[model samples]
Target: MDKPTRLIEFESMLFTRHTIPFNARKWGAERELDRSAYVLLSRIQIDGPLSISQLSQAFGLDVSTLNRQTAAMLRAGVVERIPDPEGGVARKFSITTEGERRLDADRARSIRSLERVMADWTPDEVAQFAGFLNRFNRDIERLEGRPWPRP
Candidate 1:
């Protein structure tokens, strides 16, 4: 298959062009959180006390962007900076109690949304869809020359 044709079809299945902008609005209306900030917080809450550099790399963002987001989180008391136990020039951040509360609320809302969307789906169908989605992601990464990393 031609690369452009394949890419177009894959993206169409994965994303709705019209609904792309709508997701941010929906997420914000549901939680009073900006989509970018919410995504940043979710990443941190799931995988922190990580350094700013780590986050920047993981999210494919620049240092400045990560710093700005981290600063906002700190000001909101959603994340706290701590001296890196690993001893670095960089400081580490951990999710605070408020952060956990926010994460839990967001998770609950997401679960409800997913449940409602999938109400008619059978458990077996859901499992198969999830499995295929995972494989699709892996295949795309491979095609892009990103070999899957070890867990």
Candidate 2:
């Protein structure tokens, strides 16, 4: 195939692959937390507290959308709003102990599912795939000027 054709095929495959994690069988059905809440908790865990505006910029989402999501999170006790550590007027969201516990459990479940799916893959193959995926994400983040902090 020509390069352009190949790129198109790759993009389609990427979207298909992205859906795997969101599949109910893989990660959704086993968790009480919705994907949005899990993702928000994960971000706060990695990046520290962040205001809705900051999260909106990082995720390329609207402030109103984040406001709604964070409101739900607050009701669930997954996060708490506090004065921004940077002394901003806006409040930032931070994960609570309950959120941490739930996030960790959900993450463990997802990892187990992935492990089962990749049971036949060699360790080297797994490591190489992880490296490539990480590189791809980092490059995109760089271009977007919203690089996630490295664990």
Candidate 3:
């Protein structure tokens, strides 16, 4: 049998190959969403409003890149800048109702896709898969010092 470490590496690569297309798919062909908006909305939805600086720290992205993404999100009407509820000097991005609607729709679609993929798996198997994936994500976050807020 292959070493567990080697097997995991190969499986992860295969997983990315299948899932990356969810983002890397043909652009402009689908009205669903771009990955940036989905991720940003998800982050904000989970953690509340975030300043560009806060988002940078959260995602390890530079301010300029976030500016561009947030600009697109603004034009898309998915997010709005609001005075920090905590009265911080910097403005923070908050998801609009439209953003919540879009995020919910996309998440539901993703969940349905996963359901089909795991249809044959028993409930215990699904639960175990979720537990393992969560642990894997937490370890990566711990090593990177960029823990994501979970809801």
* Each model's lDDT: 0.72, 0.85, 0.86
lDDT of 1 at 64: 95
Q: What tens-digit string does per-residue lDDT give for candidate 1 at 1-151?
A: 9998899798866666433223534544356355566777677766668798888766677989888888888888888999987888778988888888876776676666666667899999999977987887789877765433432
Candidate 1 or 2, higher TM-score?
A: 2
Q: For model 2, how does the per-residue alpha-carbon lDDT over 9-72 read when each residue is reduced to its tens digit? A: 7986976676544564644446857889988888899999999888998788989999999999
Question: Pick by lDDT: which candidate is best?
Answer: 3
Model 3 spans > 4 angstroms off: 20-31
Reference-based lDDT, residue 100, model 3:
95
Candidate 1 segments whose C-alpha is farther than 4 A from its true place: 1-29, 140-151
TM-score (C-alpha) between model 1 and the true structure: 0.73
Q: Is candidate 2 or candidate 3 better by TM-score?
A: 3
Q: In model 2, what is the error at residue 55, expressed in angstroms? A: 0.8
Stretches of candidate 2 off by over 4 Å are 1-20, 26-29
Q: Which ten residues in a row have the lowest lDDT in candidate 3?
A: 20-29
Best by TM-score: 3
Cα-lDDT of candidate 1: 0.72
